[model samples]
Target chain A: MAKTIKVRARAKDGVVTVKMLISHPMESGRRKNKKTGKLIPAHFIQEVVTEHNGNKVLVANWSGAISKNPYLSFKFKGGAAGDSLKISWVDNQGKSDSTTAKIK
Target chain B: MNTKRRLFLKGSMAAGAAGVAMSAGLLTPGMVLAAWNEGAFKAKSVDEALSALMGSSSTEAGKIKIKAPDIAENGAVVPVTVSTDMGGVDTIAILASNNPTPLTSSYELGEGALPYVSTRIKMGKTGKVIAVVKSGGKLYSASKEVKVTIGGCGG
Candidate 1:
């Protein structure tokens, strides 16, 4: 599987700001296919977890109401430059992806 | 008196079982996420969703700030930011009152994280975007109404 997640973490004044973008359809299962005229299945992400320096920082539960190609940004404390940050997400269809970035 | 004793025993037994389960690593995040808040996500109204998600619909107005455009040009992707400076905040939940599924997302912040989240959500129509923050076990909420030029959910 290709890398479906893009993440960046930067540290400033002992605070780390993390931004991530996940590539997913985020289909609400309510929209109809323009060609098939059939309802699209709901295939959005359900869980997102972020870790800083191997410590769990945040866990987000999401629904199909989120926009396609979701973007999320958050902040944390006690992080420094050169620390590792990891982000992972799982969709309703049982598919998942993760990425690791360094705090700069 | 007998009924009360039996209930107490049952509660203690359940607590013991849960402790064992946690010690045995049976309650990992992967296992828990498999059972996402289905009832809350499927609820059509804000009250139903709130009660389903947090078991309470009552919230006190607080200093939670919701920063979003007054008018969203594209309902499909309306940017929103919910933040608060209150201490001991552990959870943040976002809801769109008019969407088919009123609850859009809920975030659990750990000890190292701050009480802030920024993301984009879909709005079916013009409605209030509510941010509910759980701090010190109390729920605080703030909302902003955003006018949508076009509906997002494709009917």
Candidate 2:
């Protein structure tokens, strides 16, 4: 499958700022299908983890209230250029995807 | 050809088992992944959601900083950033007071991670965007009312 995550990590003054956009519907289970008139089942990212050089830096838990195609940005200290950063997410339906990026 | 086909079947079985384990809560990838507060996310009120996520909903106000728009043209995607300078920050949670399910996102910061988070959340209508920060084993919070011209959440 094609990667569902896009990440950008930049190191500045010992801090690595990471921004990521994940492709997901984030259906809240409250919206109804326009034609079918049936509520859409809730399917959203439940957990997102970020690792910096094999060390867990941030872990986020999200509800369906998050916007579709969620965007998250965070930062961590003590990171340098060329370090590997990994971002992954697990959805409510047990779907998961991960991608690794290098700090610039 | 038989050997290659056997390898394919073995790989698929492993993948299927992983999917089942993940859905059954038997395979938690990370320690923090178990912190997904289902009760908190399903809570209808802000206080209830907070209490479910944290032990208590009571918080010291004016310490955390919440950066969001005062007026949101689109409630479906309101950008919010919560940050604090307080040391020993453990967690950060964001909530939309007027949404059906108030809690939107919660974060646990690991060592070396800053006490900050930014994301976009949905709002059913004009409501207060609350940011609660847990630092030094205490909860501190700040909120800003965001006026919404169009309601989100399909309401």
The top-ranked prediction according to DockQ is 2
Model 2 regions more than 4 Å off = B1-35
> What does the i-RMS of model 1 come to?
2.5
- The two-chain DockQ for each candidate, comma-separated, is 0.48, 0.54
By summed lDDT, the worst window of 10 consecutive residues in model 2 chain B runs over B26-35
Q: Residue by residue across A1-104, what tens digits does model 2's lDDT show?
A: 47999999999999889999999999999988999999989888999999987888999999999999999999899899998988889888667999999999
**Candidate 1 per-residue lDDT over residues A64-100, each given as its tens digit:** 9999999999999998999898888888876788888
Lowest-scoring 10 consecutive residues by lDDT in candidate 2 chain A? A86-95
Interface RMSD of 2: 2.5
Model 2, DockQ value? 0.54
lDDT of 1 by residue, B1-155 (tens): 69999999999999999999876664454564556888888998898988988888899999999999999988999999999989999989999999988999999999789999999999999999999998888889999999999888985
TM-score between predicted and true chain B, model 1: 0.77
| Per-residue lDDT of B2 in model 2 | 92
Top candidate when judged by lDDT against the true structure? 1
**TM-score, each model?**
0.86, 0.87
